[model samples]
Target chain A: MSRIPNAFAKGTAFIGFVTGGDPSPAQSEAYILSMIKAGADLIEIGIPFSDPIAEGPVIQEANLRALAAGTTVDTLFALVRSLRRTTDVPLVFLSYLNPVLHYGYERFFATCQEAGIDGIIIPDLPFDEKDELQAIAAAHDVDLISLIAPTSANRIANIARDATGFIYLVSSLGVTGVRSEITTDLESIVRVIRSATDVPVAVGFGIHSPEQAHAVAKLADGVIVGSAIVKQIAADPAGASNKLYEYVREMKAALGA
Target chain B: MMADKKRGRFGDFGGQYIPETLMNELLDLEVSYNHYRQDAAFNAELKELLDNYAGRPSLLYYAARMTADLGGAKVYLKREDLNHTGSHKINNVLGQTLLAKKRGKTRVIAETGAGQHGVAAATAAALLGMECEVFMGKEDTERQVLNVYRMELLGARVNAVTSGTQTLKDAVNEAMREWVSRVDDTHYVLGSVMGPHPFPTMVRDFQAVISAEAREQLLEREGTLPAAVIACVGGGSNAIGMFYNFIGDKNVRLVGCEAAGRGINTSQHAATIAKGELGVFHGMKSYFCQDEYGQIAPVYSLSAGLDYPGIGPEHAYLHQTGRAEYYPVTDDEAVAGFEYLAQTEGIIAAIESAHAIAYAQKLVPTLSAKQCVVICLSGRGDKDVAAIARYRGRNVHE
Candidate 1:
């Protein structure tokens, strides 16, 4: 059989987080393309929740802006529904656990499958208490991504064991926010995660600049950029489309992908 | 003697009413419960934990002087009050806490009304080294400050909900909503035989050991089944457990007394069985104190444990099905019963359980002179001793 598409199978991946309806749907398409052009292998689109326990202020503001723009579960569905029309870049939707639970697990997965969402990352929900959801994810074939926190090497080993699609490693101890640098133990996290499985290990939460992404690129299978992109879009929600795209592309170039 | 077999029903009381998100999870729990509930090893493990960890096989105390003072019927107390944490709540908590760990969950969350369940849940969580959060109404936090402090000392976070009515119903809604979101890594330890489907059935099953052991102890002591068994009803766990083993006896009468703070006719009451109408809240369909429009209305009882507006759905079904007769005992009667018990039996009971004592107090005179009665002393009077002392204008410190 022919191999999977080169963009997806590419060794070093670029993951982009664009708040759906940020700037506008038209701008969202533009930002997505710029990231695609700059070697984004997977696109992590966020559908925000009101009580986001795991997110800090940047993404929270982006979610508020998106909510203010009438973006919703339906709107996110519609975005995925529309994106399926043009792109095949693997789509990983970052959402708080409540919206997904409120939407009902099976229906959400069915909707994801219908809208072509490739994976899910719910930061607050850990792995062991996932028996019910695990069945739903398996049934719909929508990957339920896992996060290994900074503290638990043994739990990281276990979470890495239960993970499917790709392992989403949270870069710090706290909620998602901008940080000064990736920690000194960053390489060991990658090594520990890699030891648990051969699945691609993507590091997310704080990488904002090309230099930071490049620094992490030396150690991770992929780098995820969220708060900065959301911050840029929030700064100019109306004129944010092209600027957001350029920012994503510049970060990608600095990572040398 | 499992009242809720097949559909997890206690008579026609329990069944599932969950969103589709939980269908698969509930199904798995049902399968495991059905399988493990009968497995010898499962039963043995649960029994060992109940004995060693929960300090079970509580005692059957002969209320000799109280029996002589009543001067008619013989009364034996099934002392659930003497258990660890000073109540029967530990029995259910230890059971569910262990089960949560077995299911690979790292944390537990629970909602509390009187705070008995919250403290019990916190105790189990601390013992098991699991993360625990107890959701109490902001109003309840103020009312039940001692229990709140007790829960905090157990290393559990006590979340105060200010939304909705700021009571048991509101706390439950918040807890269920939290469980819906965090089901991936947490087990919601429901405090009573309330909520939808499995929980009413699940919690009842855990607490049933109370009545099961009581039945055997009663058989050995009284040489026959008690003429009646009574327990107070809040969300109905203690009552259900006390009556569960007696359900099949056919000759044994089962009674549940709800708190009527003043009278059922007055607004100041938690008499769900007497004054409630058909309504739904916190997952289960049940009898709730509601307006003509069926909107949930505020309910009051001096006892924090009986302040909830709705009775457990299984209790409702048992009432409707005529398996158990329900009554509402007023505050004056309950306080009188509490004082009578402490003076005569030398045992204090939680104010909530005093409702049952008051019911039994009324029943003893009316029963045939030789008849036997076992009133479930569901919890100790220690928690309510301060309030009782205050009610009588006596210095509790003295």
Candidate 2:
């Protein structure tokens, strides 16, 4: 029943991410619709947290902007409900565990199902600690995405085998940001993940530029971009929708989708 | 012994709630720590550093003047202020840096609030010949300027973090980010019993030497255990160390004093246990001062060391089980205690430790003279003289 599988049913999937309620809830909804219109296969909406340790300066600043705009969990759920009326794109949430825990697991996931959210990616909740919310997420028909980094050498196969929706492969060793050059051997890491499961592998973190997306699409099933889109929104909040549409379109075309 | 029922848990608290990039490194650190904790040679080397370099077996001095002034319980002060780095932070820093050396780590990084832990880490790194870097809040660097110079003189790079609520918590966030960037030849020498897994346990074990020595010292001097033991709690390293050996003693009370900047009722306070809720941040599930939306609140305190938003997980477990008692001590009362100790015993204790002294001032008068109490004097107050003078409206330059 999850729409995550359909995202990768085509050739390579183009996943675009933006922090929900960034600038404003209305603007965020408009931006997400823009990406969807520009051929984004799946969309990841970040629920702004107070301290996002996993994020870099770009997304951290965006979280502050969203929070400063008086965005809350209830407002974001309303935003999603509005989006579902027009679009059937596979939507996911990127959040830290605290906000989800504060919202109560049962209520948060049930609301996710009602709002038409297909999956979630929690950067702070590693595979060892996923047992706290794994069952509850599965009971609600939501896929709990798992991440594998370059440091996750032996843990790659074990985590990939049990991952649902898709596997988020970190392109480098640091926090989320744009990098001039990613020198990590992602092809070898993707090979280990491919050997362990049939799930789609999507690379994110430090990914930007069409050339980088095109190169990554060759080895993985999807190419995910976050900070690059967030930077566009930060530069000009009111005009971000058009910029986001063009950026997502360029990245998706580079994926050869 | 309060062994964790789960691998990294203390009751329903304490888990490795971190990114995947750091999980393998934490697991490896746990394995290396477990191996070295029991190895006799490693223990002997650490013992040498603690005894010769850091000055262990700190005295349990009978505070005759303070006892007569209070006119109630007999008082003893555990003199951790006399240690080489002027605080109890040296105890854990020596152990961690030595362990990092044994594990073949070439560099060490840490986060500090009052700059006590930063100085301690730099000293240990210098002694062990490892590269050292410390992250401190930009606000803290202004308040504790001299300590910043101390860390620099000891050969460590001090990074002024300017993130959210630029304080101890932000420093921790920046340190974790830096560690994620380079975990191969680096070791994050966590300063307190607050971080993920091995840190809370390992730091506590290293600091448990406080109560281990004090218990025997009390027995040798008083011929019996004290009625209560008291220490201030920030990230709660010293308090946990002071309370660890006494946890099995049902009759001995374990007390912790928290920093209430203005008062617990006001928004300007760092009293986590008094006003915080349960949430996960900074790699642990514990009581944190946060908003209804789970955003970490900016906490305030006169003492930089205790200006943290969350408490250690073990402290959270201890509070849940009602094994220990915690109280909020306002900055005014702590300043009174600071002056009281300096005038009575001629010992100026750290403001963070003065919180415990403030609570003792209230509790001692209610107890009978036959009973006794011991307070952990966790650090020296030399670094606080300028700040304290400024707070009293005297604006003395450092």
Candidate 3:
């Protein structure tokens, strides 16, 4: 496996997610730059899928908005290629399997390599089906990040054993949405994941506020905030940059302390 | 056509392409299905319910009048329309609901298109004393108001989905989203032979009783197999059921009629097999109406039940392997077929099932007199009368 530089090595990495082309590609690019400027150690750009079953209403709407804006895989690759000229914040793609399949797996990974994308996280592809895409992803030096869920009690170690770049620790049992409480016994899950691999585990799903991020950061190597950032972009597309910057700054601060 | 348990595949189609949050639940469900599928007690209970409750062993009525009118092939109709709840949907819901109870799940949720599956699920939940909820498109709830009311009367809550095209596909997306959160206590009774893994395989097995019964009845009456077996395809549940038992009978040509809303060439159609690309949606890798961007397009059909963007993975497999032939039937032809069956055979069929009859009308005319065609009359037309009346510009209420 060609090892791409790991962003989780940065202390308490604060990752921000935004659906590409939410509002417009230009505006979304600006939003991402601002989040990075505000202290997001890593950036996750969601390639919009028609049906995002793992997401709640907030991210679902964002996907609808992006697709309506005529966003496509080629468009996102072009946008990321432009972003590569400017930033070095470890870039990852979040999308469903169909787009990747339709785009052609080998071409998709080769494009990601050219676009300077370090990883891909397909929510629909579980650990069992990772082998379908893992070989190609590794060949392109693009990590096919694994997600460890609370319900993945026995399968955590198996998933973590082959996990590259980082392991995404799902802090809750449901789809991606803001929640007041994450009831999963994350500590025990994390212990199992840690025992299997030296890869950093970045907790995600349902983590919204600074307090939630801070609470999760204490147990994991990093914290990922998705719907919360996508919500800001959707709530005020015109002024998303400033709002997202402030929100990411606060969440980053929580991760630090 | 049994799918492999580990791969969950019908050839290159049908796999568990879902989020990790729901992986354990699907795996757990697979284990439960494997264990109970062979259990004699489980089979006995399900068989008893199917026989007494859903009215299993639906008649294989030889349509003498239709046969005489066609002047070619002998015609027989598998009367799934005569089943309780007026459709074959009860067969699957009964099987899944019974399994849910076995797993100690106290609640069940499902997605519906034309409201037939919703009504069936509501009936099963009420019978079993389990909480039930169904997600239906807002457009469909209004169109199939009678079925919605029937579901409510049967003690199931119905959620009107307004997302995407506000049709069957969107309802499935909403139900799947809801399922992830309540995976522990609730079982998702997927309506069609679609979705992730066990759902496609399991639902087909339950509905396969249709063909299993038909095969024996046909042999008893005709002393041989029919020349062809036909059913409508949306997510392809009824079609798969009708074809499963007859797959090995190579001479029995398995035909699936897809809804060509306006025409296959036009933007308005749900003919996935005729005009679709291989893509994953709602968990299964199948043929979908997708654009160059890989986004599933909003599909249209006069029949709400056939207004789905994708077909079941097994249907895709069948079509690909040349084991099944799919034809497109326009709305105009389907309406004519609906009225023709009513006049010729004195049977009014669901708009979804009429698509198959429409195609059979064309095919039977070309076949030899000794040949026979068996049509899966998937549901009755009571739920579709109002909609059909509106489409034909006549108000039955008037």
Report the candidate with higher TM-score, 2 versus 3: 2
TM-scores for every predicted model: 0.61, 0.99, 0.98
In angstroms, give how far residue B395 of model 1 lies from its true place: 7.9
lDDT of 2 at B298: 91
**Per-prediction interface RMSD in Å:** 11.6, 3.1, 2.9
Candidate 3 per-residue lDDT over residues B1-398, each given as its tens digit: 11234578999889888888788899899999999999999999999999998888899999999888988899999999999999999999999999999999999999998899999999999999899999999998887788888899999999999987788988998999889888889999999999999889999999999999999999998898999999999999999999999999999999999999999999999999999999988888889999887888889999888899999999999999999999999999999999999999899999999999999888998999988889999999987787789888987641
Q: How well does candidate 2 score on lDDT at residue A225?
A: 91
Which of the predicted structures, 2 or 3, would earn the higher lDDT when compared with the native?
2
List, for all models, the DockQ compared with the true complex.
Answer: 0.03, 0.64, 0.63
Give model 1's clash tally: 7
Q: What is the clash count of model 2?
A: 0
Model 1 / residue A245 / CA error / Å: 30
In model 1 chain B, which range of ten residues has the least summed lDDT? B1-10
Task: State, as a TM-score between 0 and 1, how close model 3 is to the true structure.
Answer: 0.98
> Per-residue lDDT of A1-257 in model 1, one digit per residue for the tens?
10112333756677888877665565676677767766677888887544343555677567656655666677778877777787778887877554565566788888888888878876544453355367886677788887765655556677676678887877764556778876638788778788888777888878898888888888887888888777877787665667766776787777675
**Model 3 chain B lDDT-worst window of ten:** B1-10
* Stretches of candidate 1 exceeding 4 Å from the true structure: A1-257, B1-6, B9-13, B393-398
Q: Candidate 3 at residue B364, lDDT?
A: 91
